[model samples]
Target: MNLKTYQAQTMAQALAAVRRELGKDAVILHTRTFRKGGFLGLGSKNVVEITATSGVNVLHPTEKRELLNPSSVRRNSHTQMERKISPMPPRSALEPSGPAGRDHSESISSTNRSVSSKDYLQQELKLVKQMVQELLQQNRKQQHPSVPEELFSAYMGLINQEVTRELANEVIEKVRSQLGPSQIMDDIKVRELVAETLTKMLPAAEPITLETTGKSKIIALVGPTGVGKTTTIAKLAANFKLRENKAVGLITIDTYRIAAVDQLRTYANIINVPLRVVLSPEELRQAIDSMPNMDLILIDTAGRSQNDDLKLHELKSFLHAAAPDEIHLVLSTTANQSVLLSTIKRFSSLNIDHIIFTKLDEAVGVGMLFGVMKKLNRAVSYITTGQNVPEDIEPGSVGRLARMIVHPQKGSEISDDNIPSIAAGEIL
Candidate 1:
C-alpha cells in the first residue's frame, strides 16, 4: 500500500491515473490548483495536485488475493508453476469523457453551491446586511431635491407621490437660505418652513377666545383620528392643572367612536377633572359657553380624515363655534410624509396656530420635520415621545430638533469592545 501524488493540466488526466493504478473502486483523496501572479503581457501558469491512495487491503478482493506470503511459497514453485496471465487494457490506453461531461458536472456543482451560499450568508450576513440596509434607507430619505414636484416626479416616474429626498432637500435648502435670520430652523428646519407655508393656507383665527379669567376652564381637544389628539390634549390638560393650577374641564366631540368619549373621560378621571360628552356642534358650543367661569378652553375635535372635506368642514363648524384661541395642529412625525404635509395644509384653513410633532422617536428621518417647519413654514410648539401621560411630552424648540437632524449616528446597543474577534491573520 502506498500514497502517490499525480500532477495534470486537466481533471480527466488525473482521474484516469487513479482508476488505472487503483481500479474502479479507488477513492479520490483531494484535488487543488495553484497559479502564479502576472500582469499585462505576462501569463500565469496553472498547476494541479491530486493525492491518490492505492492499497490491496483497502482495494478490491482480486487485488488483495494477488498478494501472497513469500514465507509460505517454495523456491522451486516459481519455476514449476507456469500460469498463463490474462492481458487487459490499461486506463492510459482509454479515451477521455470529453467536454460535455465536464460542463454538466460543473453546472450541477454550481447549482448546489448557490443553495449552500444562501444558508451561509443568512447566518453570517445578518447584522452586516441590516446595517447597510438601514444606511441606504436613510440616505434615500434624506437627500431632498429642490425641483418642482411635477418636474422631479416626471424625471424619475416615481409612483410614491411624496417628494424624494433629493428633490425635497434641494427645495428646503433653497427656501431656507432665503429665510431671514429671525426664523429659528435647525435640522427639523422644516418647522419654520411649514409655518411659513401654512400661514398662506389658513386664515387668521377669528380672535375670540371666551376667556373667563378666574374660573375653571372647560377645554375640548379635537382633531382627526389617530393623530394623538386625545393623548396630546391629556398632556396639555395635566400641564395646565398641575403646573399652572388652572381648573380644567374636558369635552369630547368624538362621540361617533365607541370608546372615543370613554378615552377622554378616563383622562379627565386621572386628572380629577370633569368631562362633558357633546354629540352635536350645537351641544359642543353650548357646553363651552356654559362654562363661562373657566380660564382656558381646550376643545377636542373628532379625528376627521383629511380627504373628507365635508366631514372636516363640518367639524370646523363646531370648532368655529367655540373660537379656539390656541389651535394646535398635532402631526405625527411617523406618519407618511405626504399625509403629514396634506394634513397640515388642510387643517391650516381651520385656524391652526401651532403644530405639535408627536412620535419623533418613531421617526427615522427628520425630512418631514424639515418639510413641516422650513418648507411649509409651520411653527412647532412641542414634541411628544411615548404615550406615558406627562412624562413623555416635552416642549420642543429649534435647538433640540436641529441636534437630532444633524447628528443621526446613534451608538449601538452592543458594546464594540465586547464583540469577540478572531486573532489577527487567523483567517480561513
Candidate 2:
C-alpha cells in the first residue's frame, strides 16, 4: 500500500480528503498538524492534529498483501509483523491447485504460518489477562478476603465485564492464575468462580456477642468518608432492636460530613431510637454514660481520610471516651487493595474487633478483599448489601455473601462507569 498524506485545515476536511482519494477502506497510517512548517498553502502553521491508523483486507495484490503472503512467511518467526510478504496471491491459488504440486505445498505452508501466528497472539492475550487477575487474587490472599461479598464481586465484575480490548489478543494473552477455566467463557461458570474467589478471600464470620445480655455492648462503626457508616449504623441499630428485641441507643460524632447528624437523626427517628450528636470527647463520654439503661450503644464517627493522622487521633479519642466494647472497621471493597490494607493496619492499633463490609450491592472484585482479611487476621461480622435500612443488613453468612460476590457480573466487562466509590458517609 502506498503511504498517502491528507492535508487540510480542519480535521474533518483532512479525513474527507483521505476518504475521497484513498477510498473508505484505505488504511490511515498517520495524521499530524505541524505549526513549525510553511507560511501558506502547501506550508501551514502548527494546528490541532488527529492521527489514526486503520487497515482492511486486501482482495488484490498490495504491499500489505505482499507482507501477508505465505511462501515468504518464516516458520521460526515469532511475530507476524516480522514476516516478509509478497503481493496478494491470485484468487485461483487460494483454492486448492493439485496441478502446482510444489507451489501448493508452499501455499499450505504459508497458510499454516499465518494461522499459527494468529493463534499465538490469542493465547498471549489470554495469558496476560490471567496474569492481572492472578496478581489481584494473590493480593486478596495476602490480605485475606474480609470485604463484603457484594462490594468485592461488583468491583471485580467491572474489571472483568466492562473493559474493552482495543487491540487483538492483548488482554486475552495475559498470564493469570485467576483465569484457569473450568469451562472457557461460560458466564455462569465465570460468575461462580469469581464468587468462589470472593468467598475465599473473606475471613470466617465471627459474630461478636456480649455474654451478659442484660445490657447490650457498645459498638463504634468507623471508616473514611462515604463508606456508608451512618447507614450501616442505622442498619445495625435496627438489627439489634428488631431481631434481638434489645433497646438500642445511637450516638453520632460525624460532624464533618455534610448533614451527618441530621441524616443519622432522621434514621434514628424512623426507627424510634434515641440519637445524640456529640463533638467533643467529653460529650461523647457523657453521651455513653447518660444512657446507662440502654441495652446497646452504637456510635457513628465522622468519616476521615486514612492518611489524616489528626482525624484518626480524634476518632481514637472518642473511642476511648465511649469505651466501646467493640469497634467494627467498615471499609469498601472497591478501594485500592494495598491502600485499604494499610488503612486497616493503621486502625488495628485502636483495637477494632470485627470488620463490616458495607455497600455489598456494589462492584465486584474478590481479589481485592484477599489482601484485607488475611492481613488483619480478623473475621467479618456483618455485610450491608444495599441502602435499604434494617433489610439490607445481614449477619455475615458465607452462603448469602457468596451470591453477591460475582453473580451479577459475568463477562459483563468492567469500565470507569461500572466501578465503585470508596468514600464514607457520616453516621447519624
Which candidate number has the best TM-score?
A: 2
TM-score of each: 0.49, 0.53
lDDT of each: 0.54, 0.59
Worst 10 residues of 2 by lDDT: 419-428
Report the lDDT tens digits of candidate 1 across residue range 83-112: 100011222212233332322232222222
| Residue lDDT tens for model 2, 306-412 | 88888899889888888888889998765666667888977887888878877656745543453466567777777677888877765554434455334433312
What RMSD value applies to candidate 2? 18.8
**In model 1, where is the ten-residue run with the lowest total lDDT?**
81-90
* Best of the candidates, lDDT: 2
Query: Any idea what lDDT model 2 has?
Result: 0.59
The C-alpha stretches of model 2 lying farther than 4 A from their native spots are 1-63, 66-202, 208-212, 398-428
